[model samples]
Target: MVVSVKRDLYGNGRLVKASDLSLGPRQCMPSSQSTATSVIFQQGLQDCGNTLQMTSDWLIYSTNLTYSPTPSRNSPIIRTNSAVILIRCYYLRHGNVSSNAIKPTWIPFSSTISVEERLSFSLKLMNDDWSAPQTSTVFTLGDIFHIEASVDTTNHVPMKIFVDSCVATLSPDATSSPRYEIITQNGCLLDGKQEDSSSAFRSPRPTPDRLQFTVDAFRFVGSDNSMIYITCNLRAVAENQVPDPMNKACSFSKSTNLWTAMEGTSGICSCCDSMTCATAGQSRRFGSLYPGHSRIGKREADPVKHWLLLQEHKVTTLGPLLVISTEQSQARTVTPLSSLVQLWVVVAFVSLSLVILTIFGIVGKRPFKLHCRKAGLK
Candidate 1:
């Protein structure tokens, strides 16, 4: 009996196209009417056409091509020759190109990516000349101050930049000033220098590696005697080899935090409470990068969390704090002197005045005596 069997077509693995695989019948034993059997199989292959592929082992017989043979009641058959499928991201489903194909599975990159490799930034207070202040190191209320920021080469691909101001210390009234503001924000690009659009989402130009801004101390505080902390937050991304339009290239992979300090003291009364910080964009090189797609918004990240994570991430930069005083405070002598030195200066001044008075009294008496003698002689 020439028994034939057709294997099951459905499988769990990825199926290869007939062109990718070399398909041929398994060798069979020579028997009666072998030519007829071959002709029947060849006809079936032709009917299936170019699209059909033989993945599993199939048996052919002259007795019946369509008939499915079951195991004899006395004998059970164990069949083996299953196909292995390797599912890939580029495969087309059911030979349909119009329909969306299998998408590449994205695995989240290591959240522990080193901050240095991802992005870096710095904050500096500059003078009108754009040079570091030499004499006026402290920021005074009403004083026009300039600030400069530069990012590391790795993190120059930022999508948004933010400057947040807050009172680093608790006030006597048990209140704290913490405010968040967007300095430069655009969907996938940085704000242009000349663009006047009020919308924070528009980017008329490319992002720069360095940026600058000018701020008036009094205007920033609205009121005086508070320590202010300004931090820079940057949202950055990393990309993959293959790009797609149906979805983003990749999600935001890094966050960079750079900060500087300023103090608003009573002498230089500040309007920090009422005054807001100033911002500007400088020229820097920018490359095409993936747009931000994280659940975290541009300005919605928790300040407390960011502050806490700075230490954990080991990404914070330390620098001296700039003191901001009101014009009144600057005029007042805040220099401290030793009590002994002050007392000694007072005693020395009193002694010098008394000596001068005694000398004048002696000289006047001598002159008067001489006049009396001359009159008596006359």
Candidate 2:
């Protein structure tokens, strides 16, 4: 019985094909030998017209695998293992154009995929405008374009895409003159709560109900220096679902490029002459706890009284007007009256005690002792 066999063949015997040992869907016996693996890739390219004349491409790669092997003495094998790979690529187009003159644009495009094939695709330009037949196209100043790309993750597999670099070239164009002024406007409400609402000042949490406004003004100038003015009117309505009798209006202006509220005639002119303005004012008037008096106890008598005063003084000439009404209840001081009553009570009790002590003292001092004596002893 001295017949020695190969240690690997002692447990099992099998043959495996290299092509069958993939990371895909397949299984094998201990000695049969099997493995599975797959890879996916994606890429994007872009080309812009005169503003951005160049070609760029990026890459993304991913892979996964699983393998199992039988243990053997002569050819020892591990149990099981899995592996994965991920990669990303980025390409930028470069040319001899100046940096200032290049205005690049990026647009995304979609890709097609097949079920059996590993996910892989490229974004190509549909029009020849992005690429030149002979040399790469050149972009000129003040030009705009689009770029496109797509992912075949249609297979519903977890995958990642990366953007490497984006480049563009620019060159001067006689006919490529700049035009159109850029104008931006923003509005906001502040119902005793939040402030600005623009992305520049957004909070993760919900803000108090308020209106916000912002404006950006731009214009192209040829030779002569000039000034431009912009005007805007803003109004706010309470969404509380309750009927409100108050009027809420906000008027704003920018002079010397500064934002300010509009008041009367003079203030109106200031805002009307500015290039940018934000008109924001509150309409909901708050009533005072006290009817006739201001919240601070100032004697305005009533809203009519305050209005009359405003009219007489012509305070509206100032920029932006804010009118508020508040009422405060009257409070009387009772400390003095209580102190007077206590002092009177203490005085009366002391006077009565002194009178009783005087009467007792007089009676105790009287020498009314009666003594009887015999005539003979005397």
Highest-scoring model, TM-score: 1
Q: Write the per-residue lDDT of candidate 2 for residues 101-124, one digit (tens) a residue.
A: 644443221122112224332322
Q: RMSD to native for every prediction?
A: 35.2, 34.8
How close to the true structure is residue 132 of candidate 2, measured as C-alpha lDDT? 24
Tell me, by lDDT, which candidate is best: 1
Report every candidate's CA lDDT. Answer: 0.32, 0.25
Q: Number of backbone collisions per candidate, in order?
A: 20, 38
Candidate 1: stretches off by over 4 Å: 1-146, 154-177, 180-207, 216-227, 233-352, 371-378
In candidate 2, residue 61 scores what lDDT?
A: 24
Which 10-residue window in model 2 sums to the lowest lDDT? Answer: 312-321
